[model samples]
Target: MPATEFQQSSSSSSSSSSPSFGFSILSRRRDQVHSHSMESPPAGLENELEAFQRQVADRFHDLSAADSGELLSIPWLRKLLDAFLCCHEEFRAILFNNQPYLNKPPLERQISDFFERSVKALDVCNAIRDGIEQMRQWQKPLEIVLCALDNQRSIGEGQIRRAKKALIDLTIGMLDEKESSTALAHRNRSFGRNNLHKEHKSLGHFRSLSWSVSRNWSAARQLQAISNNLVAPRSNEILSTNGLNLAVFTMSYVLLFVMWALVAAIPCQDRGLQTHFAISKQFLWAGPILSLHERILEESKKRARRNACGLLKEIYEIEQCARHLNELVDNTQLPLPEEKERELRITVEEAGNVCKSLKDGLDPLERQVREVFRRIVRNRTQGLDSTGGGD
Candidate 1:
């Protein structure tokens, strides 16, 4: 071989025989680039996530079943939901970006856990979204009922005013007739006893007219009283029923938003080392990782499928009650009938029951979600540690 060619060939052979130093240097450079790419995203995301979390927490922390006014504010509610969804999307992106490392042995469990979290979060979002849609659906009916009540009130007030004015005019006419009859009686007494019988007859006529006027006035007053009583209760019933429905709607959102927050927080924990080992193991994988992944998927699927149908049915019942109230308010009747009033009360009670049942369902669901995710994180950490030590 030529001297220069020989030297070059020997150097190439040496490089091939031991490539660790070169590989390590190259890996360090790659890691630096990867970390740089990761830096801005995680830092920015952390602040975004924390702010959202704090807002959600603050908004709901003190809220209770009674705080429907604040809870039912649509603009506030929409903003709250938007914050939750934004957090979810950001978390999803972070997970997806890490997907290149997820499909293998030990880290597969953690990935499965993440997938589990994502699915649960999505389910909660759907429930909240459904409830919000239902709330929106009530808007038109609510407006219709309010307008109808206002129009009816205006018309009723005008009628009452007219009735009072008629009563006043009748009383004045009777008073004038009474004064003229008294004057005639005095004149007849002065003129002589011959006109005494005529004066007595005229006085009798005036007395009869006064009695009739009194009866008419009393009847009018009674009717006005009845109308007032009727209107007061019906208005109260409609208002109370609608308020309960709103409370139920607000409660659903609160529950789901809380769940979403929890789900968002889970994947924010450290998983990179576990993921690396897992992906590396994929090349020659074996044992518990596969089983763990399956278990995670199955458990998550099972948990997510826990149906809220009962709660949904109750929500529908409240919706029906809302419709009923709207119809009642739109009626020309000042007060709803006794039977209808009983029914209104019943509907209100049923709504309260449904809310209690929904709360009962939510508590268990929350517990189950927390437990499942906890198990997942525990398993992922333990599995990765054991696998690493074994290797």
Candidate 2:
């Protein structure tokens, strides 16, 4: 046993006595990167999520139909509609009261008398015939109005006055037709083969075009709403409710639309039942006015371009108006919101809402009117031969 051998033995004994952690292969790294290595896409997504959350927050504030109302639903949209109708009536009386619709432009006095007396006093049956004629004439007016609207001064007061007269006349006619059962019955019987021949294509074409334009206007209004925040879609607010992301935001839309619906459908507070009845009484008036205006716009498109330009524009606008109404009728969405109902009421009112006076539906009577329109077109265009006999 040498001294070095004894020292080695003592070191071995000490090593055997102590407990030890597993041996470290690497030293503690000062600049070591800590990674959530097992995690896919990294925890860096957290920041992006935060930014998205911020954007959603921003979008939520800009929404319409909220506690902070940016728009009041179009309760008075009928006023615009009424004004438009009135202007159209005036336009017709100004253009074609002196001569039959197909005749070349009548002088100003003829236009004048048409407005002041006969035009103002026309009954509903005549108005319906007139409205059909107006529809026939709509194509030319629409073309004219569109061309004018594109120009520097689209709207003229004189033109507007003329247009308004057309509307008034047509309204009176339409009201008469709707309200006067006698007139409606006559209207039903009047469209024989001759008239039907004239109306079929012309009415179809104008109605179809008008329908298309109306759809376009509808789309435009929707876009405008999105831009203008008139009727804004709410941001979806999802809060945990009974273990579901129950939509809290949906209620707002439902509530706002309901309010708008109620406002629009319910007659205006200022305009009582009497006013509605009076206005409705003039339903048939729209027919004659519409016819005259349509003819004038057609003629003016060739002759009186300056003032008639307004009539032309009205022709298109009326189509647009009708298109919207038809669209409302066509729309099959659930709940038929208040806005649509009100819109329907207003449009029917424009034609003179006699629906209230009906028993079941207007479908049967509507068919009769369509037939009469057909006959009118045939008589005007092809020669109104009464089938060489009678029905």
State candidate 2's TM-score. Answer: 0.18
Which pairs of residues collide in candidate 1? Answer: none
Q: List, in order, the clash count of every candidate structure.
A: 0, 51
RMSD of each: 31.6, 33.6
lDDT of 2 by residue, 241-308 (tens): 11001111121122122222222222111111110101111111212223322333344344423221
List candidate 1 stretches off by more than 4 Å. Answer: 1-73, 96-100, 104-106, 120-129, 151-153, 156-391
Off by over 4 Å in 2: 1-38, 64-69, 72-161, 165-207, 210-391
Task: Score each candidate by Cα lDDT.
Answer: 0.31, 0.26
**Candidate 1 lDDT score relative to the true structure:** 0.31
lDDT of 2 at 212: 12
